[model samples]
Target: MDQTTARPETQHQSVTFAEGLTLDCGRHLGSLTIAYRTYGTLNPAKSNAILICHALTGDQYVAETNPETGKPGWWEQVVGPGRPVDTEKFFVICTNVLGGCMGTTGPRSQHDEHAGQPWGTDFPPVTINDMVRAQKRFIDHLEIGRLFAVVGGSMGGMQVLAWAALYPARVFAAVPVAAAAYHSAQNIAFHEIGRQAIAADPDFWAGRYWEHGVTPERGLAVARMTAHITYVSEAALTRKFGRKLQDTAQISALGDRFEVESYLQYQGSSFVRRFDANSYLTITRAMDLFDLSADYGGVLPSAFAGTKTRFLLVSFDSDWLFPTEQSRAIARALNHVAANVSFVEIKSDKGHDAFLLDEPDFHRTLRGFLAGCAEHAGLS
Candidate 1:
């Protein structure tokens, strides 16, 4: 983990939607353009397609150069040519979500008409359903009638659930890691605090500051700092930093006067430089509002009713953001509906980020589940 040089930027191509399409947020986002990238070739039957949904801060640059920061793909460990995803066998596709700033249509993207400036504060509010709907359009545009599997973690996991609930027939299997059907109260509160931090910054200017050659860097940095703390476990922080001071002068401080504080500060600062503030606000809000039970008459099991898609839900022991109980709840509901589902609560001290990091146990479970999916799909 050398912090010397910056990562390489990932280039992306633009995709536009047809005219007269309305978004779920009650706004007309006409002539929408999205930035995305793809890997591997689709088989002649188009049945080897796999969709890799990205997390809140991720984009379509899976296993490719990151356009925002010139570096290897964020999930390169699991999504390359002979990796767990095995691009040699599956046509893996990843895209920037509709409300993301990485390349998809978001507050940072320019509106089609009306002076052709950045949408900024005028950007419509987006929901998880909206993102899934947009993805459906993208898949259709590619002539992919069905996906062999939909896999993701965190916010990406939420999209997997949305896809299963909204378009179950189109998905053969799903892998949702470290995610919940709905945002917990604690998670909602954390997101609200981050939103407040961003809004309080004078530079935010109601999310319209981008066009003015300004950004709410301080506010975004603070928000990232707060969220980063929750992504890792207390055990990890203790083992890695454990009150070890960066220098003698800093040790005299009252709180977090350790190497971890400095490390988190760097992570926070670097994040603001690469991500947009308004996009953060939009995506977090979408996560907060996601509730599969609401659409199923308050019956979580009903959400998966009549769905033939197999499910594999994984949770980390240290993941308080979406605890094991949340994963179990989803499993229980899927069982009630007689849907094929498997649940695994991995032993880890890495918290919610264990799925993204190199955890041997998590990888083993993922590999097994994917193998089973391949078998079921007859993709020998």
Candidate 2:
């Protein structure tokens, strides 16, 4: 099944489940739509299905060209015919999560209850568990009884952990890369700064930018630029840009003189064109409120009680955002519960973005884990 070809099982699709999803904040939506894309073929037994959860800004176009950006999929490097998550052997499903702007029910989506206006500020706040719950509904809609594995990184990783914690029996294997059970104070602070940047723009108009026919592009770009700095390490920034002048040897007070500054500007400007500002606020708030221990009476191990899912938790050495300690803590909790788990910390200075980059050792680790899980699941 070529990725570019449109098929019932391989093309982009959306389903509005009339289950009337209720948010963690106690607000309820009349209905919910989940936009998703599938790749490869499902085995007759339906045991070869793997759900690939996306990070904060990622969409469902996991292994194909994105219609919005016309660029290759975000995880195209690691999820193809012979890649780590090889599509040839695994039925891959990726979805635009709840509170997502890419065709999923989010701040930008229209609500019938609101007279067909966009949800905007009225969209209820969501949590990681909420996103996982929505994914579960979508999975059930597809009639997949159990997933072979659930894999993700960053916020995607957060959803993976939530899935394994909330519905342990339905998941055979789980891989959560570069993520923690809870967002740290530093992480929340960074997100707050980004949110503040978005809200401070005059064009925001109290989250009514959509109604005003204007967007907070400036504020959104600033937020994206600020957030981008935390995605890479100091070592990586220095190595790649290093005070190198954007042009000839002349420094200006205008402050776009350095290559790094120009690069951040480009990243920020490009992001606003594809993302909505209100959606940014909604998703970051969800990430901030994600705490696995909260549901387990402050005992992280209790969350995994009686869990049968196998876990492979991977962290990067240079990922200060969610460092090795976070992964080790998760491993410790799983060990306390006597659950099957493995922990790996790959050496890399690529920062939190290492999981998405081409790291051979990381790829090998994923392939090895998936192969082991396949054997355990009796997949030929």
Clashes of each: 9, 0
The residue ranges of model 2 lying beyond 4 angstroms of the native Cα positions read 1-12, 248-250
TM-score of each predicted structure versus truth: 0.94, 0.96
Model 2 residue 5 lDDT? 17
List, residue by residue over 57-174, the lDDT tens digit for candidate 2: 8999998998767768999888989999999999999989899887778988776587758889888899999999999988998889999999999999999999999999889999
Residue 377 lDDT in candidate 2: 88
- Taken over the whole model, the C-alpha lDDT of each candidate is 0.85, 0.90
TM-score of 2: 0.96
- RMSD in order of candidates: 4.5, 3.4
Q: Distance (Å) between predicted and true CA of 139, model 2? A: 0.4
